[model samples]
Every structure is written in structure tokens, then in C-alpha cells.
Target: MHRARLARWVAGSVLLAAIGWLVSIAEAQEGAAAKAPAAGAKGEAAGRRARAGQLPPYYREVVSEEQRQKIYAIQAEYNSQIAELEAKVAQLRKERDAKIEAVLTPEQKKQIEDLRAAAKTKRQPRRQAKGNAPAAAPAPSKPAPATPKP
Candidate 1:
């Protein structure tokens, strides 16, 4: 029992040290990036943040290997159900959007497309300045000026 406790303590200590080392390395890289203004450091840092895996960050520190495996198994079991629901939701959205589009006149639709293109053009220079690719913006929802009612 004493030996088991000692081993667990040693393992935990090593894990903590490794985590600390990794954190320091990340901080060092960030510091270097901050010092170099032309490097587009913020975009790189944002990309790194986005790449954090699907697991909660705490899982890396607190969860035992066995518990992690069990959690992964549970997630796997739910994944198929989640995927099926997501597909259904997507199909429903597409059908709903088609119905909405059917209600709009061709002129209104063209106007919406024009507004979206304008917004995209306005955003392009800002994205380029930030060293990021221009992403498509959602179409502006401003309804055309209501024609005077008959």
C-alpha cells in the first residue's frame, strides 16, 4: 500500500512537471511572437487556440487513463446518434431556406446578393491587413425599403 501511494505520487509529480515545461515553452513562443511585429502573431496564436482538441482541457490534467478511455468509449457510442441528428437538422435547414427563398421576388434576391458582395469586398482589405484569408460574411438582412402600401 505504501509503495503504491509512493508510485502514484511520483507519477503525478512527473506529469505536473511536464505540463509546466510545456506551458513555459508556449509562453516563450508567444513572447517571441509579441516582440516581432511583422509576424502576424495574433493570427497564428488564434489558429493554435482553434486547434485545441474536442476534449475538455481539464481532461489532460485530472483524468486518469482508464477514465479517459471510458469517456472516449461513451463519446463514441453517442457520436453516431449525434451525427444522424446533425444531418437531419442540416436537411431541415436547407428545406426551410428554400421555402423562404421561394417567397422572395427575383429582384429582392438579386439585391441581397449585391449586398453580400459589397460586404465581402469591404471586408477583404481588413482581413488581408490582419494576415487572414477573407471569409464569407452572412448576407445583410436589411429588408428593401417597404414600397408605399397600395
Candidate 2:
């Protein structure tokens, strides 16, 4: 009779242990499910911010291997394009300045220098006002003055 009672107690303890494990598993699954939507929402917000030109928090750290390769490729392309454009612009400016030098007399060169200085002065206020103004406006038509009778 004591052996039988011992066997029943062991069986009951095993059953209770199994039940506790299952309850713990169920609770973990429930907690994970509850947290899933919050994680998804945060991911979506980060994506939106990145699209709007704001860097995600992860961007503050060292980039991953894949991202580093991508950045290197992009930098190489930009550098190539910038070097090409700078060469072209420098050539164009050289040509323009040479032409201007050839065309101007000494007096005209002095006048051109004065004009350039005046234009630089005038440009500052215009540049400051440019952001607030419309880019262009319609031209006004002028009425012809009265013509004398033939």
C-alpha cells in the first residue's frame, strides 16, 4: 500500500510539472504576440523617417559590411562624375575669360571691373530676397502714346 501511494504521488507530481511547463510556454507566446504589433509599428516609423531624409538610429553606428560596400560604390561614382564636371567647367571658364581679355581695351577693362564690383554689391540684396519672392512675374504692356494725325 505504501508503494502504491508513492507511485500515485510521483505520477501527480509529474503531471503538475508538465502542466506548469505548458502554462509557461503559453504565457510566453501570448506576450510575444502582444509585443509584435508594437515592434512592427516602430519599424514602420523608422522607415518613414529614413524616406524623409532623416537617418535612422542605426546609421549613427559603423555601417554593416554590405552597407559599406554600397557606400564605397556610390562614392566612387560621384567622385568620377564630379571630376569630369569640374574639368569641363574649368575649361569653359578659361575660354570665357580669354575671350573677355581679348575683347577689352585698358579703359574697358577698368570699366568692366567697376561694373563687376557694382553687380556683386547689387547681387547680395537680391539673393537675400530671392527665397521669399516668386521666381517670375508677367510683363506689363505699355499703351502707345497718341499719334499725331496724318
Q: Pick the candidate with the highest TM-score.
A: 1
Distance from true position, residue 11, model 2, in Å? Answer: 99
Task: Tell me the TM-score of model 2.
Answer: 0.32
> Root-mean-square deviation of each candidate, in angstroms?
23.3, 34.2
Per-residue CA lDDT of model 1 for 63-132, tens digit only, reads 8877765666555534544565557557755775786688789999999889998887777767867879
**lDDT leader:** 1
- C-alpha lDDT of all candidate models, in order: 0.64, 0.60
Off by over 4 Å in 2: 1-72, 124-150
Clash pairs detected, candidate 2: none
Candidate 2 lDDT over 1-150, as tens digits, reads: 789757856865676566556755775677467655577776754454344332346673868767754554444434434565557557755775776587779999999889997776555556657774444432344578799667
Stretches > 4 Å off in candidate 1: 1-54, 130-150
TM-score for each predicted model, relative to the true structure:
0.49, 0.32
- Model 2, position 6, has a per-residue lDDT of 78
Q: Compute the lDDT for candidate 1.
A: 0.64
